[model samples]
Target: MWGPHLLLGVLVVYTFGRVRCQFQYPTETAGKQYQVPQPPTYKPPTNPAITGIPNINTVLVKPPPFLKLLVAVLYGYKINRRIKPTPPIKKCPEGWFRRDQRCYFFSDKKTSWYGAESLCRLKGGYLAIPDTEEENNFLKETSTSEEVRLQGAPIPHFSRWIGLRSLDGSTIQKIITNELLTFTDFVPGHLASRGLTSEPCVHMDYTSSFLWKVEKCHRGFLYICERHLHFEFKYIV
Candidate 1:
């Protein structure tokens, strides 16, 4: 009995010592507080200043070549449209006979050939030069009319001095214009039959149907003068 009791007391003592040692030993996280994980902070990026940029309000750009030419043409056309146009020519003056851009005047008084030419020059004209048969007919008709108007009034002679004259007693030429007398109405055989002793100037015979005849330049007769009609243009303001 004493041995069994002694063994039982020794086993109880060993078990109590093991339990107290376990309570006193430190744990892996002993005396430390638990913490939540923290999030990362964010930062914005910065831009650097540039030195060579131009301002939009101050910038100037040239137009294209075609656009510039088009603008210039339009401006020129506008200016041209504002300019005035020229007017047409006017009619001849009063008392002047207008015939194919020319004017004719018949004298009302008798004068020598040289005197007649001087009168024509004073009036800014020359002795008439009949270039065509029609012109010659006109002169003849005018002379006939003048004689008929006279009603056989007595005069020194019934003839008119024409522009034709023999410069060297051979070739007949117009003294006023110096043009050759290409047209003539000399009576048949009258020029060749005239005696060579007398110097001759041309005349229109009013007494015998205005036939052309050679006469002395010193003889007094009525004359005709001719000149070009002047033209002028009128304009609007």
Candidate 2:
């Protein structure tokens, strides 16, 4: 007994309800499709602080404290190998004695002052000149030593010629260098009382306790030669 308009409206409402129940609105996680989670591929470590899941090709390594120190030592040794060592210096020449950085050669034979000068020059040196008390005493001791006696000269030889001479008999001079005598070991009254005619050359007189005395230039006596020492270098393995 309902009106026709009301019946029509009821039918429309029923149709809308059935459509909504049959197909609902799509949700946030719908049945579109689900992908399986794949394993991560291996990669070289870029940062040591970051640790990743372990894989077949991945390995984490850290150097020990001693290993770093050993590497540093090896690097220093390699740098040192590039540098060369200094060569060693050589010593005195053959038949020459070294003293206070000077080389000396003692003669075995006796010769006049001029002859002695020539012989010393032939040996690449000049007649020995004593400049200090130490040097003077050294010459005195060596003159009477067994080293000189072994040269067939009698022990305690009376005198030995030196490089001193005075042409004017007033000013003493070194014969070869022509320099004025700065040091003298002359005996008292030796130079002041000596006559000019008989004495011009000087000699070391053992009788005067190895003091200097004026004598004739023609007298023969043993001599000494001196030269500066030259140091050399030799490479060693």
Candidate 3:
């Protein structure tokens, strides 16, 4: 009887030990809850060579509205200065003959000395005053050609009023320019003083090779007008 009991007790002790070992070390199963320790997360090391370099982000930023407008204005002004510069005016207008940097206009109609001056003023000019022999010759040739073209015949005894006049009926000078008469083409023994009392105004006798002759201021005669050449730029848009 003691041997059977002892055998039974030994069997019981071995079976309990086996069960406790199985409980401590359980087997992996399909429906068991378990927490696995994750391995250390892998991280790539930073490069020390490029660590100090500036970061270049390609973000596009817009300029302020006023700054953009100012830049546009400056660019436009530069282009305009290069392309549309102001030009100087240096030529005579139409119907006015240019000669030695001056302009001349001979009239076909006759008028008194005062009327001639007033007409020249209306035409943006003054009574023609010949300052040199070349200018006198130019006036002579131009007048002769114009007269011949108008009448179809040579004028044998015609005179034209000039800018020379004796202020206070004494000293002769160019009335329009207030310049002394440095040059004169007077006939011999027929100087301006000879007619100072009767005629205060001077005239050019085209028949006598454009010689100077004093005449009455009230007398009507053809006249010449003079002006300076001027030019200006005009945009043609």
**Relative to the unseen true structure, what is the C-alpha lDDT of residue 20 in candidate 3, on a scale of 0 to 100?**
85
Q: Can you list the residue pairs that collide in candidate 2?
A: none
Tens digit per residue, CA lDDT, model 1, 64-167? 44454455445534543443432223454455555787767777678766666656555555577778899888878876776676656666565887777777
Alpha carbon deviation, residue 172, candidate 2 (Å): 1.0
Candidate 2 steric clashes: 0
**Using Cα atoms with residue i matched to residue i, what is each candidate's TM-score against the true structure?**
0.54, 0.54, 0.55
Model 1 stretches astray by more than 4 angstroms: 1-95, 152-156, 195-197, 231-237
RMSD of 3: 35.2
- Candidate 3: residue 75 Cα off by (Å): 56
Query: Which number leads on lDDT?
Result: 3
Better of 1 and 2 by lDDT: 2
Error of 3 at 137 (Å): 0.8
Write down the lDDT that model 1 would get.
0.66
Ranking by lDDT: 3, 2, 1
Model 2, runs deviating above 4 Å:
1-90, 146-148, 151-158, 231-237
